[model samples]
Target: MFSLRLLLSLIMLVGIVLTVTFSSILSTRDAKHEVEELFDAQMVQTAKMLEQFYVDQLTEDQLAQLISQPILFHVDDSKIETFAEQANPNTLSYEHKLSFQLLSSTGQILAYSDSSGEQQLTTFNPGYDTRIIDRELWHVYSFFSEPHQVWIVTAQRDDVRQELVSLIISNTWRAPLIITPIMMFFMLVLTYYLFKPVKLLERHLDKRPAQDLSPINFTLPTELASTQKALNSYLLRISETMIRERRFSADAAHELKTPLAIIKLHSDGLSDVLSSQSPDVKQATLPYIEAIGEGVNRISHTVEQLLLLSRVDAIEALNKTDCKLQNIIENVINQLVHIIADYEWYIVVPKDMIINVDPFYIELVLKNIIENACKYSPTESLISIKVTQDDQQTMICVADQGCGMSDEEIALAKNRFYRVDENTSQGAGLGLSICQHIISLHHGELTFSRVQPHGLDVCIVLPRAQS
Candidate 1:
């Protein structure tokens, strides 16, 4: 199974990493650009300062001599000069890559650094340019001195600019990389803390007993409040359903007592009549015997239907198997042989058709539907049972050629204890309800229709199960 927390954490971590990486790249690029601009500014300032000082104080020949000589300026000595080499006492680094040159208006190089060799530093365009000198790239900035009719050019090696840029970009990445682990640890902790309510809800459910269906109420974050409410509502509905079942059981028990008492009374009366041994007494005993038998059968049928209803309610899953349609219908007919003895019944079904269903429940449903057809149907009338199978569904229909019911009666027939003809004593009005529920358990539907020319047709449609 996939984990929610792991997925969420991965998304958050990846988004953070991408954001940090993009920000670092932009910052490095901006910092390098700024550093290059500052270096160029420094070069421009040096050129301007030399032009102001040298143009009035020294002739062109004097400036030429100073640039050609290239004297090393010591660190302890405080003589500031343009592109001067300052020796370091602590570090013995000797190379200074900065150099200067002076040129006349006619493009003749009047003076240049000894380290510069014979390289021309600039294009004399009064701006910055890159040029290759002695097979090494150099960054040069030139300024034309209008008053002295000469140009002062300052040049620095490209390696120095590249080294500074690398240092800036490397430092830009080092700080975030060093602290990324700590940030990620905190992020994980925060994500876990946010999901604590869900864990608590799981543990709470785990601790509850299976029979408990009470509503749950907990103080939680806004994100989880709706989930808690939905769970509570489901529990409340289950509790309501349980209450209805309990009330139905009590009603059934109360209803069974009347028939049992009638049976006992009729049995005692019949026994007394049989003991008398008179012709009239024996004649009277026949009706009493019939009454007792009818009561017993009615009570037994009611009890069986009640028990079947309760079992259907309690069953959480159905053990469906391949059952022959003809076999189940034959079994139902055999079970109802006594009741249907007076009626002409017909079974119309294919020879070897099978359906996937719980055999016991299906049989019970068949018995109830067929028994109802026998009860409401007139004696010697035709009762037709048809089982048909197609690619989409399996249908079992029980139709009776008797006095059909009204629309109102058909609508109320499925309600427990609701009888179309209350005067009839054969059923407790639970047969159709039980049948409907059993079919529903298999994810099927039960429908009632009036047969043409005066009869009732009841059908059960079940979806075809995979082989």
Candidate 2:
């Protein structure tokens, strides 16, 4: 996945590094130029000083001796420390690299530093120039002295300026190298803080319940203000739509009940009248009357379930009371006794175990679960209602022994109108969905599991009533 935070951090890091690198390159180039200029100025000063002081003081015979034989400056390695001690301790070791030559106006070498050797540094150029002498590059500055009638050529090895420039550039880069990581760390921290509001909004949405359509109440940045406004508006529209849907379902179901009851009453009366007629007429008409009654009963069941589901959907909060688990289970079983009579029921519930829930809704939830068990299980099969409690919650499980549901069916058992075997059952399939909604309103859970050795287990978990 592409992370916005990572992308932003990478962009910022790359931008900062590029900026630093560009600055360093410019700084190094300028420093190299300034170093070269400073050294060139020193060479000019040395050449002028040599002409003004030493060459001008030379006698005619002394000048003639300089032209006779070239001088060389050689030092023994053993005496290098003593030489350094005699001179200034801070004197650079590359001082010998700086050499000067005195030439007569005719371009003949009149005198030279011992290190300059017999060769001229350059072609007696009167200004700054670069030349190679003895395979070593040098920066030479040649000056003409009218009174001395000579050329003062001062040259320094190119390596001297290069090494000095390298030292300066290296030092300059050290600071940025050390500070880059610290700057990156601060940048990451800054990015995190800058995007904190976005994360807050994401977490708010993630943790919110599906039924919760309330507007967001967070202080967001101006950048996200429009997004927040749009989100709240959408939620408002959804809430209004859901309210309208629930009202319609409840109203429709209520309207259907009276008509269905009238149809059932007439069908039952017709069935009774047919029973008193001749055997052939009674047999022929009774089945049709019973069929009509059955159809009415199924419609009534569906309408009642729809009404219950709509009511459960509308309840956002519960008026919870401490209700005895045993009493709730007994009431549910009594209501379903006619159908459950064929099944062997095993009830294991503590008489005093209580749950904090709305009594009416909890009873309805139990009735749906227990009735489903009775309907699905075969005659004489085992059905168990077990109540268990822990410190924080109470659990009630209803298990039935019959043909068990597959994993796919169990997964969608709580969805409305999703029957495991729709062909075999005459249900609207809203029973578990209603139970789920009621349990959710109580801050409880409803779950379905496939029981081993063939059956279904429906468990309800509600918070334990405080003592």
Candidate 3:
């Protein structure tokens, strides 16, 4: 079975096919009709010429004399031969086939032109008039001046009519053959013209880069406005959903990392401590005990953070609060002293700067961003954190002069488990999502962009709470 779209196109093509076929059949029928008309007209003219031939040669009084002549079993060929010699060759050639017969109004056969038969009565009526004719049949209306009589003549063979009908049918089929290519060309062009937007949309989709989720920028005509609007709406929704999912994943990884590190540390310490103990004496080995404990703790930590991420992803994170931004940054920095200790880092925030936010949530946001920078940056690379007061908001930016990311990598940074290079950076993909949730909670905007020359730059804009 064909698809619905394909079926519709095929139906259109079929309509064209039927139209062409109908036209061809009609032309053939008309041609056959015309051929019949011509045959009847020629037959009438032949009868008239026979009338003229008799008028030119015989006097009015001699008509009865001719009629009174004895009927014979065969024609007198000698008279016809003399007649043919006296007439023009073309007239003889044309009139040679005109059969003649004498008939009474009572349908009695009197005589025939050839006098070849007397018993067989042929069909002749005085009632012939304009009417549809059968093939090879001719109607002749004639007058005998001497007897002052009229007669109708006809022939009954179907040769000429059948030949003409065949010719018409044959000739008519050619019309469709000639017309098909033209109709097909037009149909193809029309189909393409109608489908241009859909094809273009597909091409645009195919060419899109891996991380690009921007709005479609193709032109759709006014006729397709509703369709274009629908597609655009769908695209926007998908982009938003994908962005949200990516943020959630990154935050979950970052949130679980601290607990994961602690479990691993504890497990290692337990194994070292149990290694010297008697292995044969205790069936419940201390190493296995420690391993199970660490595994359970790690799983629990990962699950709990994932749940928190899920909640933050919900709509409740939009609720804003009043808090101090500068204090949040200070708290985040102090939490990461050991991680940033050996590296050269600069903080350019003013002492008195503050902004409205959920204080604890904002602190979590700062901690995630700062800790991510500390983890990804190479040794001796400078990490810069700045808070500048804008007219209506405070702009907090954390950037590092480490390995910069392309547009694709920068956009992917917030996705869970996404690291610039996973083998080099020890991270679970949860940091940026937590920061994003905190930003959302404070009604602040957090965006990631590539800094000039190298490295990733994250910007956080929080509207100032007026004093």
Q: In TM-score terms, which candidate is top? A: 2
Steric collisions counted per model? 0, 1, 14
Worst 10 residues of 2 by lDDT: 75-84
- Models 1 onward score TM values of 0.51, 0.89, 0.46
**Candidate 1 per-residue C-alpha lDDT over 189-293 given as tens digits, one digit per residue, 9 for 90 to 100:** 887898888888889899764546778777789988998888899999988888698568757866886877777776877677687788887886778687777
Model 2 C-alpha lDDT versus the unseen true structure: 0.83
Best by lDDT: 2
Question: What TM-score, to 2 decimals, does candidate 3 have?
Answer: 0.46
lDDT of 1: 0.79
Query: CA lDDT of 368 in candidate 3?
Result: 77
Residue 236, model 2: Cα distance from true site in angstroms: 0.7
Candidate 2: deviation at residue 131, Å?
Answer: 4.1
Model 3 spans > 4 angstroms off: 1-9, 24-61, 64-124, 128-147, 150-157, 165-170, 189-197, 220-225, 258-285, 292-467
RMSD of each: 13.6, 3.4, 14.2
Sort the predicted structures by lDDT, highest score first: 2, 1, 3
lDDT of 3 by residue, 1-467 (tens): 64444565678779878887888778877887787678667656655664566435545455455456623334223333322146554444223233454444444444454422343224443323332232224334433323435242433223445655776686677767777777777777777777788789879888664345567766777867777777779888987896688577657766776777777777677767777778763346865766677565757655655766665655333445565666777788788888888678888878766576667667767777877777667888888998888678888899987676788876777676576776665445666766665675565778888777777788888887787
